[model samples]
Target chain A: MNDTSTAKTGLQSEAGAAMKQNRTAEGTVGEVYVDDPRMTCRNVDVYYGEKQAIFDVSLDVGKNQVISMIGPSGCGKSTFLRCLNRMNDTIDICRVTGQIKMDGQDIYDGGLDVVPLRASVGMVFQKPNPFPKSIYDNIAYGPRIHGLCDDKQHLDSIVEKSLQRAGLWEEVKDRLDQPGTGLSGGQQQRLCIARAIAVSPEVILMDEPCSALDPIATAKIEELIDELRENFTIAIVTHSMQQAARVSQRTAYFHLGKLIEVGETDQIFTSPRHKLTEDYITGRFG
Target chain B: MNNQQQHQKTMERVQQGLDRRYRKERHFRWLGLGAIILGLLFVSFLFITIISNGYTAFQQTYVKLDVFYDPEMIAPIGETDPEVLSRANYGGLIKASMRQMFPEVTNRREKKVLYGLISTGASYELRNAVMSNPALIGSKAEVWVVADDDVDMLIKGHIDLRLPESDRRIKDNQLGWIHLLQEQDRIEKRFNTTFFTAGDSREPELSGIKGAIAGSFFTLLICLTIAFPVGVAAAVYLEEFAPKNRWTDLIEVNINNLAAVPSIVFGLLGLAVFINFFGLPRSVPLVGGLVLALMTLPTIIIASRAALKSVPPSIREAALGIGASPMQTITHHVLPLALPGMLTGTIIGMAQALGETAPLLMIGMVAFIVDVPGSVMDPSAVLPVQIYLWADSPERAFVERTSAAIMVLLAFLISMNLLAVWLRKKFERRW
Candidate 1:
């Protein structure tokens, strides 16, 4: 036990030395901008009361493209995603500064109403959070709240279409009156996705949407994400490297409350510009 | 080999302690079972004592009398007018009938002892019969009248005949009269309708809890109406909308403390604020209900807040993420999820209100009200106050009545608690 303890300490010191060498650079690297951008965030900083959570971070989500954020836990990836639609306003101590704009309109403006912004920029959570209601009611809730359709018939068609777009129509069409919670984890996640889709949002933020799911369910979600990219701009926070690589066109890497790199998915994986991003992708340390 | 020996030694020590551990566990199990049995024994004892003591109050004794309604005695002017019928001396009719039954008793004191077998209220019964049917005047008819309370005690076997005549309320002469009536099947025990239908009376046989029950019903109705909505609103605002700060924290602490405050304080508050300042009528259900509502508000608010807090925050996030406003999210999702729990809390608070005696007594509900209250504004006495009054009375009959009133109050409390449990089970939802 003494020998192994000594050996572990030795390895930790060596890794610590390497980490100290890489800590000299403090800002993001690689391409952080895109042509034909849909939403732009510049120098975004988040603070929870006295503690700063996210440093100055700038990135762009392109039109009709999938952008995946990958980082270790508590790396502010989910925090940054919540900032896109001002969802952080619900937290009492959470304070965000810096500019985030969708279609050249500042979402953080005091005069801007958050309700419409949220409706347009929908969210899917880390866990499947279906309302304790019927499956049909779950999907129809978003549309009814937003008054997207004029009549019940229109709303029903919207629900059916959204479910079809989520690739869940066949499995759940006969049981729409049953509770959404009665479904399996994978199906419930799809129901949440369909609920998001029913509002016809222009942008969707998914915060580690596959973490609580089994691998088979995770694979199904990746497939759904690929198909969903045709109509909506999607930004996903994920821990799984394979999931980020498979579905996202662009990938951004975060480390210790700082954005380290952002680029094309293939370029970032093959030739990371920053030592931290390369070290993270190569599994040296998260 | 040395490590293996040490492991074997440890195993031996563990095996030795396992027996003692199992013995302790068995002892604990027996102790728990004994405690449960003891609790059940106490509960059953209470039930037996109450039921045994109170069940006889449900039946009353009646004496059969052959009444002769003579025209001269009833209407002195011989007109048989309605006023004359109502004001006539019906006691004379009862005495004449008793005289006809026992012709051998001629002395005035013996005749007075013979008349003592009937209740004073029996004259009113005869007058009502005469007024309802005036044709019965100047004719003899057999009627069943309520017997006196002493004769009732004797018939129910509560008054022991083996005791000396002075020790018991019923003397030998009265016992003989009762025996003679019993031999001819003129004494009977009937289900006590007056106990359910009539209001409180000085006569134990004429007293009933109908007034108290109506008073309780109206008080609880007013209490529920005032407490439920206001409590739920305060809970929702504090839980969902209010910012977390020192003020809200202080408010929360005060609410919890208010629940612990003695109930009579609220009655004093009602007495000062509602009766003295606002000048609402005293001893009315309205005042009692308002006082009870003040007492019940803290309990309901605390329970409702807890119910609201039990809803998972993720559901709130889901609703907000879908662009629902905070108010809309609460109305559409969170309130529906928490309603059953809130209802349960409200019912439990109501039960507490129903069983509350001190608060009502402080608010002047201890007044000896005899008339059944027709509305909320009418002066009245609630059930617990009635029980307190009856328990304090000197009459032997009021002792059983007190127990019977307690039984009724317990029945209502148990049913309300059962409803709370059923509501909880019916809507207990899982995410």
Candidate 2:
């Protein structure tokens, strides 16, 4: 036990030294644009106790663009997505460090309010989570909490418009009081989309939103995402290379806590890039 | 080749015939079903028997008698002193009524026995009437008063007068008078509203459960006022805020252990803490309710945690991802979703508390209270304790009353459980 503890401490110190060296060596490879980045992650590292999950990850999410993070299982893509919205804070042992900002403001600042931040950056989970409430209430939850609705008529209009934006208004407009969970899997996902949209967020983060869905439902969500990007900057984490290729403007490839490559999706797919990115896109070992 | 095939086919036929598998399976299934049906029937039989035997307890026989009050025996010389009225002898009224009913009973002891057929509560009733109107003391007035339990039983055909006089409280001669009264429409079984309106009494014939019911209501009121907020808050802290460390683990284990602890132990705890330490009055609904609340806390906590756990982690993720704070996510998303389940749990825990008597007994809730509790601090007994006390009494008449009390308690429990079911069905989220 003593030997293990000593060796563990030694390994941690060596890892810390390596991290410091890498940080100094990078010396700002990416350009710092004058316009505010919708999201900025700097030297972000996540650790589930001593097992480091994300290492010195830095990224800039521009406004009004769909950024897709693509990786195999256990490559820390989901972990990075979670860090964008501070969702990993829910885990007891998980710890994240370094600065993350939204609209040039440090989201992790002590004075920052998470409730409004969540309202500003809405999310659609991997699975369809339409609250066991009516479809109207599911869409109305965020708006109600933020006090966005002026009255019953205003809330009704918001619900209708959100559902319309999600491309589900025609199918469910007459049954707004029906439980959202009663819908088909595709409809449920769309209901969740409408729920998030009702909050009128500036950015939408989707974590494998189509993974649990059938092919038809996946296509519907993909179509919805395409339409959603016209108004909101979107960040999607997907394991499907085809999905990332279809929906994203830019793709970031992650492998074992490291960003192997990031570029325009068309360029990354069709042109030569990093060897690891090429290997992953061409059905090589993940 | 043909001969071998034929022999193999014959062997297969023999195997199928000799198996006996279908027969054995059918036998076991029938036997299992029979056992289940038998068990169900037995329970139903017990319920039917108890309900049938006790249903008559809800009705009582009353005798309408007109007794002339001699001014000499009551308000003499028109001296309308309230003290005289309070101290007026109602035994005289009872004696007068008995003499009018049984003119043949010349012996004083026999006449007193005959008058015993009248409820002891009649004296109190007569005194109350005379106090209200002193001028009517000299005039004959008709009054309705409850007949004794034995007389009621005899009217209901629950008693036979052929039994020896020594073996029965009412004699054959007294039963003849009861028959004559019944024939003349002077005695009749009527709905016993006093069973619901009046408090419990030492007299078996006059006892009612109104006091115990009131005590139960007050106790539950206190339980709800204290337990709901406290239990929900404790559950929220343990489930959402508390870190998963050794201290939290210890608390979790202790909570589970407390839930499994015998309810009587909580009774003892209440006796020591509420009665002895805090010096709350014994048998007060407040103390009983507090003790029951403590006993019910573990149930509420365990159930509330389960309800909280049923809320998917994704909802929390969705809330937090949008930048909602930890408190906001729980209060807005998680708690609202879990409310129906929490309410169902709370009702179930209260139902459990309602039926609990051991802890209340330890806190002296079994005290024979004759007046309905007007406040939480008033000394009182709950329905279960009343039933338990009545069941333990030596009087055979109390046996039926005990069963009647049980039926009421069972009805209350059934309705509460049904409400739980209805609530679950009404608000259950399919997520």
Best by DockQ: 1
User: Candidate 2 regions off by >4 Å?
Assistant: A1-37, A103-113, A134-137, A147-179, A182-184, A197-200, A214-217, A272-276, A284-286, B1-35, B69-87, B127-144, B157-163, B182-185
Model 1's alpha-carbon lDDT is 0.90
Q: Measured against the native two-chain assembly using Cα atoms, what DockQ does each of the candidate structures obtain, in the order listed?
A: 0.72, 0.48
Off by over 4 Å in 1: A1-26, B68-85, B127-141
Error of 2 at B330 (Å): 2.2
lDDT (C-alpha, whole model) for all candidates: 0.90, 0.83
What tens-digit string does per-residue lDDT give for candidate 2 at A1-286? 4644564466355445433122221322122222446898888889998788887777878788888988778888999988777777678899988889998889888898667777888888889887777888888878887899999999999999999999999999899999888999889988988888898999889999999999998999999999998899999999899999999987887876766566678977886255556678998976
TM values, all candidates: 0.93, 0.85
Q: Can you give the lDDT of residue B295 in candidate 2?
A: 82
